[model samples]
Target: MNLLEAEKFPFQQTRFTRTSDIQTIIKLFSQFSKEELMKKNQEVSIAGRMTGKRMFFADLTDQSETIQLKFSSENKKFAELDNGDIIGVVRGIVCRTDTQEKKNERKLSVEVEEFSLLSKCLRPIPSSYYGLSDTEERFRNRPLDFIVNKQKKEIFFLRHQVIKNIRQFLEEKKFIEIETPILVSEASGAQAKPFITHHNKLHRDFYLRIATEIPLKKLLVGGFEKIYEIGRIFRNEGIDARHNPEFTTIEVYQAYENAEYMMNLTEELFHYLAEKVFEKEKFTFNSHNISLQKPFRRLSMIEAIKEHINIDFAKINGLEEACQLAQKFNLKLEKFQKTVGHVILAFFEKFVEKNLIQPTFIYDYPVEVSPLAKSKPENEEIADRFELYIGGLEFANGYSELNDPTEQKKRFEEQSKQKELGNEEIASFDKEFLEALEYGMPPAGGLGIGIDRLIMLLTGQNSIKEVIAFPQLKNKEKNFE
Candidate 1:
């Protein structure tokens, strides 16, 4: 029958007296003989999608369980069924299949007495035999992908468990989960371009948030001691294996804490996640075995650059000197990267980031790149910031937040200058955020972890799109071939 006729049928009003899962029923009667099963007279109602059929027998599956259905030749209802059809069997007897080759190798099956069609399938499902191997098709048609591929379905199930464990861990530490606005007048949190939309009523352009940092910190100023927000962030950027325009991030903030405290907390949290998810402190990702057992290695940005490129950035006297060094290393420079701090960052990105293969905290970022981070007291040009890297991918960024209103204002002004110089990723000056800082916000430590990349690492998936459900894809015109 067609789907329309199946929907109009009276099967919706019909109820089964008792039903057990196919796998459960099979396990319960695996050792029972045919005479024993008949003597006990246990009956059950079971339903599943028909996967295979022969002359007088059929195979049905629900989720990951499968069972064989035996029917008499006179059963007209069983004769008319097709593969992929959903059907229910009533008062089916459980019996062991006949096997003369081995005494202990008998299989359990169901004997259907009365049956009814619950639904009809119009199209055949994509099968492993026919090959559902296209990556684009798998991502675009996630429901079908899950139905066909057991491993892909398991990954998403693990994703759910990962988020649950993270929430449990945070709540155990008394961290209050909170939400911030996704639409804002200004996206001042991070150095990323925001997606803009026009409000019809207000006749003003609003931005989708690029980061949850500013609002979460504002909550800290509003008397909350510890707070976190797990939400979607949008950045008008290019997409790659490691980057997506839309992504999930968990931004955490704690008052009366420094960057070092945040680093330790991050390590602890990762360790906890590793042990809970993988049942060990060491897990393999993309062929690399990573260890969360030891303390994550820590190195200053300047020291890392020195170790990788044999150049002491401290000796670079001025912007002209840094520019000369960049030219010497054949590094490409952006228009706004003329300052010494900017040049150091460019060099670090080109020469230092990939060398950090294991879990390492690369700290002491240049002040130019870290607008919201507090500057180091001994070296004013460096900020007390650390970025966690695993298998050469950045997983977390945390820093001692800059609470001085005057310094923050100056940094905002500098960012405004960068914006004027056509730096689209630089955030515009946010007067309201500076005003909140003016209200004497306490010293704090804040962190933003890329949830998708973390999942990819934990699940051994290499691409960010593999971990994200319904990741953005390029638009294509229909060919209708």
Candidate 2:
């Protein structure tokens, strides 16, 4: 049959009920299962690819269903029907069944009487017993993976469920979902490198957004009290099991809400998704079980570091001393440590982060590392920021957004100094974003959740690739030793 013709094939309008045309239905397949014929002597039409064929005592037996299809073909024409052919139009008596002759296994057999070829297969399918195993090939050709692997298909389906549930929950909360510019003049908002593209006609450089935080905040300034975006973000960074150059993130901004409220929202979102998606009220990470019954753990940055390693970062002498302590903890130290705050963050990441197995909010990070978060009321040196981590993976980050243009300008200047000192990832000041801040954005709570990482955690996938349809890989031509 022509491929296009097969696509346009109309229904035959044939219906085979149990008590009608029993002989005609039984003869459809080469073989039938005992249970196949045990259906109360009913006439049924079953169609599928022809798989196995055999001949016993001059009787052509086709193993289509559980029972052996014993039929008389003078030249053994049924055996010539190649594997994968869609052939079935059988009439058989439905009888209560068992395979007594075949002692190895028990199967119901259908007594096929007459058969017809609905469609013939010119080629055979891949062995169902041994499936496509090459990981890269499977991803590159995902349709084949879906055809052969039920588990692989289910993974993506679960991913879809996770995203859909999240969207529905946010929508029910009356947050207006918005789409912001993926291509922007300046890559402000988060401290990450962006992919630069040029507009030939405009002769200007545009960048893929590193985070939706800034644009959503801009909308907040524009009088939209609650806004959110589930967008694709690009970061020019190293690819790892946890990090991808191109990833998905959900950013939300709620005006008049503080970092504390954002933290609660984050926790509730996770718990809601977990219960609805995984159908579980508890999650186990690294053999440590956590009950998702209600509220999660809340730990300050200092408190976390203090609990993990008895160090009071608040009491540290200065930058030099903090640097020395960071060095002692085996954290990477670059050229200069202008702020002790950087060292404090580096230490917590190295010593304390890997131990936070259950859901915990590590908050009040040093201001130097959190340029976009508002400073704490009692302490100018600490910013009101919180990061949620579970399964030793950082899932979400939230904060009371810094809306003071003057303070933001100072932060940008500090970041510019670091850039001058050669930190490539420090973001450039977007004049437009600053102008938006000057227009007076509300004291809003903003969130950035790594959708890929969250999917990985929820799906029990350890690597980013398991969740991502495609992940970044190093160019084979690039030389690195």
Candidate 3:
């Protein structure tokens, strides 16, 4: 059984003051500036962890603010106090004072007047210097990690700002923010394996959605011109620093717009977010600073590959020849590789992906990899798809949707063949979605942004775990069980 099921219990009410209501405490402390209290008078009372505790005095850092507590057994009020006790009360003015050992220590000292313990700590929290080194434990008990590490908290805060700014940008552009189902019968949005569970009442199995693309597209087919959904998607895959079993993605679609328009829109959105949310007009990654200003660099897929790898993918007409070339360049390729586009992708990823530290749009992917996108007019082998990369990370993928019912069916059939041929990530065809497209989905553009990856980039966090609040972790063995 999963941890979620094992921990299932009847929902109960909470009694303590919720975390947010501490604003009253903030207001009370606002009477004295943190600096003024340190200089003129040294007094304050607050509820916080004893981050740094000592014999005579200790620093209490709370969610609202930080203040120190000076204790004496004769003082009666603090006779029963300890470092980790969650206390509440009134104290003298908060002051900054130095100790005999360290002269430069800045502290908010409080002379305890009244006190009460809201909660008591039995087990000591691990020391921050050697705290929660194991990755699984850290993710499982994430709230404690946030309490111990300040940088982790800041990264998530920046993530919220990124999402907020994106919402504002889309709303400003008249894009309606909508929601889609997480459980579905057909997961035709993207190429990924899904987690499936039995629907007891329905007597059927439903898979978790891998992407919001299909449902959002259904809305577009239903006559809504512009819409977007920022939601959770689940994929059954191996975990790594860059991948999680469950993550967030934002999908947007606009009626009558091509992939080119979406490319421009994505760049504008990212630039606006960097300037507004991050408060930094330029991004520095891997020693290269990329300015998120208007008119970002854009290049055709073939052109980018050619510039970096010195290879002409246009001339590599067959998969067999492409595989030979990849082998010469030490790229990952199987002898049974069937698509020239797949070979181009493998070659670019091996040789050129790391060089794209700045914001760059690589356009015109192989049609084999983009089942729902329109094919290029001049070269039917290529699809009108583009992916935006920043700091060597693929942030967004968009394409001009294949609206013609016949072409859409043919692509789905190809995808079905791939699925049958042991390609576990190939999408399972959704007949209803295809039927909706048959009703004539207008020529439109669709985009899916990896929200977690975007947040990681904006927050300057190299690992996806840093940006996610409670990333999925392996089930821990419970001794009680």
What lDDT does the true structure give each of the candidates? 0.85, 0.74, 0.76
Model number with the top lDDT:
1
Residue-wise C-alpha lDDT for candidate 2, range 257-327, written one tens digit per residue? 99999999998898889888899977654456756667788989989999998999878898878878877
Clashes of 2: 40
Q: Would you estimate the TM-scores of all the predictions?
A: 0.89, 0.78, 0.86
Cα error, residue 224 of model 3, in Å, equals 1.2
Q: What TM-score does candidate 2 reach?
A: 0.78
Error of model 1, residue 447, in angstroms: 0.8
Q: lDDT by residue for model 1 over 275-378, one digit each (tens)?
A: 88778787677678888787899999899999998999888888889999999999988888789988888988898887788899999999999999999899
Point out the worst 10-residue segment of candidate 2 by lDDT: 56-65
Candidate 1: residue 105 lDDT (0-100): 68
Residue 372 C-alpha lDDT in model 3: 91
Better of 2 and 3 by lDDT: 3
Which ranges of candidate 1 are over 4 A from the true structure? 2-75, 87-116, 129-131, 478-481
Encode model 3's per-residue lDDT on 1-481: one tens digit a residue. Answer: 1222322211221233322323354454546655766566533445556655566576566654455566655754344445455555444444444567677665435655555555555556666556667766777788778666766777767787789888999999999988989998987788888999999999999999999998888898899999999999999997777889999999999998999999988988887887888778776654567777777788888899999878888777687788788779877654324678888888778777788887889998989888899998898899999999888878899999888888888988988887777788888878898889888788899998999988777666667877788886655664322
